[model samples]
Target: MSIRDGGGTGEVAGRPRLAGPPTRLRAPPAASRPGVGRAAMPNAPPREFCTFYVAPPLLSPYFSVGGRACWEIKMRIARRAQRLAGTLAILVSVASATAAAGDADPDVYLLIGQSNMAGRAPIPDDAQGPLDRCVLLNDRDAWEPAANPLNRYSTIRKDLKMQKLGPGWGFAQALLAAAPKARIGLVVNARGGSRIEEWKKGTRFYNEAVRRAQAAMKAGTLRGVLWHQGESNATDPDYLDKLKQLVLDLRADLGKPDLPFVAGQVAKDSPVNAHLARLPQTVPGTACVSAEGLKTIDGTHFDTAGQLELGRRYAESINKLRRAE
Candidate 1:
């Protein structure tokens, strides 16, 4: 009944025992063990998913495996292996928890601008199914599967039927293509005929966009911004200054100094195109995507094909900006 630990040969404390050897203690069952119990982490794969295996000890020529059979020794070795498997299981569970946390917080993107950004083109028949690892911040400030008419959730948006495919759709797809495992969140808040002046900080248009962005940030981090306005301000020479201020203000308000801001040109001929072209030159973390060959449905808004292409371009630009910083 009394016990003291020593070399397997402890009569009392440190010496060899009068008996052949001290009895070995067996481990508890896997179900009762601490870490190897089960897939305890939320959203974690089952225990069977990350199991560790040990080769049978009866297969080796130089080791006990395939050598002589000893029940007590074999049981002790089996218990040690069980503990090892339990530790590995625990490590895998912790890793799963970290991945789930990341899934919970998505990569939020803010899309804002005028009608063009709101997408005036008609939805194509081949529009794909729900994007993998992507979600849209709905008008009610809730997250749902990202789909066509990404601007539908715009708090200051127009009629539903008018909502069509925009760069957000393609942008998300292209972004996912680059990093397949990443989760994307879109927070679009654009109006039909708004100009740069309307989107100025403190205005209702600007306030609503910021509000939605902040709300979405609760479940995700603001990763990038996509802008496609300037059709209304094409002739205004002061558009560049306002855009710079807008970008700066947004970065300040959103608390991401180096936040990537990408502005898409409305049309190749628009005067604002020149200003948009020069954005990246003036701003620190900004880039401009061209709509040069992109055909527009109404000589203003990008058509379905053009919108999708521009979305891919936006993804490429954002990736480069992140790398440059």
Candidate 2:
């Protein structure tokens, strides 16, 4: 008789259906039998050895022995999991401590002024000078290394023929060289060919600088404001008085009655006669630079060499003022 005559089988309609391959219901391998520990589990199925998944529930008392064995296996797995978690926590803590130690010191600086103080030099080749603590405020207003050796304000020359090298970058390098321990920051807001009229009491440029100065003062520190502009309003005879009023407004607005100001006299041989136009800002501070032989052949802007020297002169003036204070 067929095995199905005595044993019930799953049936579809009146025909009996096989319970699947007999091999599927065969007992586990001898190596996976009870009393075999983890030390002898090399030949066991992965599911029986690994604790990553839940085991099938044991419903019969015959399986009570299996249930007790499962409990012991689970305990060993839990202990190993706890040990791994603790190791991970310790590794994370150590990594954080190392990062914090490396960031113990930081540098900061502020750069503010007119077009000259905004930078107009060409990008220097091999400008890979070491900057231990210097940074530039990029065109996007993000802080980056001052390694470009050229400033964004210089891009104006493509449109405006009158643009030339200003003293901003030279000044920055000088400060970095003079105080390598300090961090540099630039807060530039200069308009090309802007006159005292445009920068006067009710105007935006002047007012904005004032507001920035106030904010800087609240922080109790401001490097200084470098002034390299004056040709635009030098033609006015009353430029001195207007400049004095401007100084008053700037100081009052910045909340510093005697804030340090750095000024540079124009180089004289300008083909455009821009040098002949001189305003009182030329003599505002005690450290005005003499631009006698430094004018470019064009009689307007400083050439590469002239601009570098101009920067040096400006830095010297600033150093003098700083030393006095």
Candidate 3:
């Protein structure tokens, strides 16, 4: 039989012709019914025929026109999923890195000067312990829990066996207490009987202090400098000039020109008390704390109570400076 063209005669030559428009063969609808696609059904019963019917497009090699479209759709979906997963992974990594950086940034304070800054009094029972949020940069260039006798390398002391209490411990404690969430790091480089001349730029003590301060800065931000000296330079005529120069040199070395330098006055009876009291006026970004009422152990270094008070005073001055900034 011959096929008839639309609007053509019913018969072609002597053969009979098929009637009407020819019916086109189409692949069956894709298996979109639940539990009937390529995916397996969950919790199917034993002996159950969970048929995952392949569409007619996949039945023959030469009839794979629809199958190509299906494969391409799947590929697009897979690429989209991979891109989404990669984006999520990158976001998580960035968030983790930011948190780690914040955790490592603490408030760092540099403590330097002479015996008073080194703490020459006996450690009080209440102050003879380590602070949780305070870390001391020791002479060995290591970070350890901050406690009493912070300036361990003071030349006046033979060993830590006879270590005396210094204001550093109390200063850290007070600062931490005032700012509960703050992580405080103390870089103590004070030495007993250290004169202002010894702390001049290019000197061993000044170089060491700068080195330690720079090292401590790696673990946190440099906040301020706590200075309590003048006992040895009391009689020097150029004491104030040398001290002012020291502050400038320190700021230059640390790369923090406006860094706060809080100096504490010597005992009331000390001959250098008058000079120390004028520190704030003589130096920029500097303040002086009073030791007028504080008692001394042997008419020189502060006693336990005095050290604690001095630390609190230093913390107060530091806080004030920070607020002004």
Top-scoring candidate (TM-score):
1
Ten residues in a row with the worst lDDT in model 1?
58-67
Residue 47, model 2: Cα distance from true site in angstroms: 21
Kindly provide the TM-score of model 2 when superposed on the true structure, using C-alpha atoms: 0.56
Give lDDT: candidate 1, residue 231.
Answer: 85
- TM for every model, in the order presented, reads 0.68, 0.56, 0.67
Note each model's CA RMSD in angstroms. Answer: 17.7, 23.3, 26.3
For candidate 1, write residues 1-325 as lDDT tens digits.
1112222321111111111244543453453221122322244333332222221222111111111211221211123455456555644653443343333467889999988788887777766555667778776576666777888878789898888888888898898888866878888887888889999999999999888888888767888899989988889999999999999999999888999999998865989999999999999899999887999777878888998899899999999998997
Task: Indicate whether candidate 1 or candidate 3 has the larger lDDT.
Answer: 1
Question: What is the Å distance of residue 206 in model 2 from its true position?
Answer: 1.1
CA lDDT, candidate 3, residue 221: 81
Off by over 4 Å in 1: 1-102
Residue 174 Cα positional deviation in candidate 2, in Å, after optimal superposition: 1.7
Ranked by lDDT, the better of candidates 2 and 3 is 3
lDDT values, one for every candidate: 0.71, 0.45, 0.66
Clashing pairs in 3: 119-166
